[model samples]
Target: MLTGIVEIVPGVSLLKGRLSSHETTQMLQAEGLAESDLIPGKYEGILLLKAGAEVHFQDYNQEVLRALTAPNVAANTAASGQHAEGCTLRRPRYFAGDWTGLPCLLEKEGLLATYDVILSAETVYNLDSQRHLLKCIKQGLRPKVGQAWIAAKSYYFGVGGGTASFIQLVDRDGTFEVKAVDVIDDGASNKREILLLSFKA
Candidate 1:
């Protein structure tokens, strides 16, 4: 099932996704797809899916897919087989400048709930502030159990940050262990990688 999707800002980081309208709702109707076939209460189905409950979706409006499924899949996985307090939904917050101030701000807002997993995509483009970024992650992650998933190009061309540079910082820290989760070479010049970071045991 498709889960969270983000839009990356070049030279900055990732942003929240906005679903666009579909131009061909007519074709779906012509295929004999009826509204009755769709699972009633889109948001209700979304909540159930987030709770690790499977919702057998027949067919529905394509544009509403994300509106109905924006809950973090990581939360679902983290909550799986656990008790009620396992899931979390971290809202999008604007921490535009250096991340050094992020920890205090999040804490002040009473939003400092730590998690078992955190996901970031295409966010390693700033070289100078890498330490601050890691510091913010350290402040909000559960010490031994939390893992950060970073998906990015192996190297960012014009920018100084990428998976290698970020991994170098993480290795130098000695607090976290880095592992190569996956590498995708989509016939592109720079291959993409999924790196997992966990506190060293």
Candidate 2:
């Protein structure tokens, strides 16, 4: 779970551009307890990790950026003083140098062997990768009881993808049951939400 958070933050930084790494750390530090509220109460699972992963973009890839911000996530986790262990970052399981080709490459090393719960934040903005993301969920998530928690703005203005559109894809396939778990109105341009997904019963 921590690793997933680590993987996600850097991509977000690339998107915002204006927030420095230090500022990002400060924001996480400031949030403190508010951030804890986002975690599930009964989570005892490892997040599927793909180390050395890059966010492929039309212009430039953010592999180096993701690598650099990963350490900060560990620093923040250490600061939070959680007693969790077994967080190891590994090179992505790449097949023919493509991230989307396959995931969980570290499985050969026996890491993140099970993913009962998957969490992603701000990852639905890219329409191009949504299919791959969904494929990851379908392949990695534990059947029946496994769940996915996706957090994003209700609508992303320029990117043309958001929770609504992602949910539309899920609805079109009927593979999972999804619901809006929480909505936070931070007085921002768009409302933030957490959507919970589970395999259909």
Candidate 3:
């Protein structure tokens, strides 16, 4: 009975020839960016689609379904002492817009405060977009039971937005309680963390 929608943007055609991973890295290096650098409003950190990178709606839909239904699956199995029945998930509706404009967009679609959970990754690296992101989450999440899980690095090297700063913003807003559910430190890069946000009772 839980329905959901996800924003999707049509793939942009690469005007030039496709580049391999190494070639793309070299090109980004020429532009003063390493392979992992996200320049925010300049580069989104995704490789060129023309370089054989592809994103499918089905893949996104599966991920969303898994994230939202995993707990239910476990609970159902535990209660029944058997595997839960498989159910078909509805294809998520799609909209395209910038984070600053997403809340309004969702409102126009009659989806305001409708979601039980929201998931995002590597989206907090831009300091300028964090407020907008928070606004969208605040307006979209259903009351009490709604939650959002954001996965990002402990700090973004060049950009100012990180889990620490975002947590401060959440505290200032006074709308949600935020906690780190997981931390990953491989010593190979910046520490990563998954923060959970939920309405304060």
Candidate 4:
């Protein structure tokens, strides 16, 4: 059984258990000393861990219940965008990659991805996420973990149009983060880009 305040600064005591509802509530009260109105609240937050791990969380009072049943923290999530799940990040930051693919994971317990592997060497000059999506379509790339590919899309600069280059891929575990970047240079025509990063597998 994992225990913590759902909103400690807000004065809430959350709890969870493998027992009956009465037992779960009692366990929470014992942990937090509920002296207030004992208002009912649902576990409103979730942690987006990698796939293939089991986890359970519940919102009771203001405390969050995380069942420490497994090692994966990637599957059990209750919110969208960036989360404040880790011990750091103060107010939790929302990540763009998560917004694109994580919701489906929450619904299906795994990746809900499509494959389109129409890859382009022009990808080096244009690094937009949309371009990556298009390249996925062209190359029949299913976005499995570890394999790398390039994507192209347009970036608008005020009244003008600009192109970008981005390397996009999902690691084997289905965690998708940007692999590299090459902002288009009209003079250079999407020339070779520096290694922005290659996310860990």
> What ranking of all candidate models by TM-score puts the best one first?
3, 2, 1, 4
Local distance difference test, each candidate: 0.57, 0.54, 0.60, 0.33
How much is 15 displaced in model 4, in angstroms?
69
Give the candidate number with the greatest TM-score.
3
Tens digit of per-residue lDDT, candidate 1, span 135-164: 877876777898888888888888788888
After superposing candidate 4, which stretches have Cα over 4 Å from the reference?
1-118, 121-146, 151-174, 181-200
- List clashing residue pairs in candidate 3: none
Off by over 4 Å in 2: 1-69, 73-99, 104-113
Of the two candidates 1 and 2, the one with more favorable lDDT, higher being better, is 1
For candidate 2, lDDT tens digit of each residue in 1-201? 133332334322111123456854554455232332222211111123322222111101222223333433334333222322444444332222223644555345342325677677776876766777787677666678878889998888887888888898888879899899999988956898899989998
Per-residue lDDT tens digits of candidate 4, residues 92-192? 22212212343443345432333222222322332233444433332332444323344343433342322332333333323344444554447745333
Candidate 1 lDDT for residue 12: 17
Whole-structure CA lDDT of model 2 = 0.54
For candidate 3, write residues 65-143 as lDDT tens digits.
2333332323222323132134322223444445666777777878888877777788787777789889988998898
**Least well predicted 10-residue stretch by lDDT in candidate 3:** 53-62
Q: Which candidate's lDDT is highest? A: 3
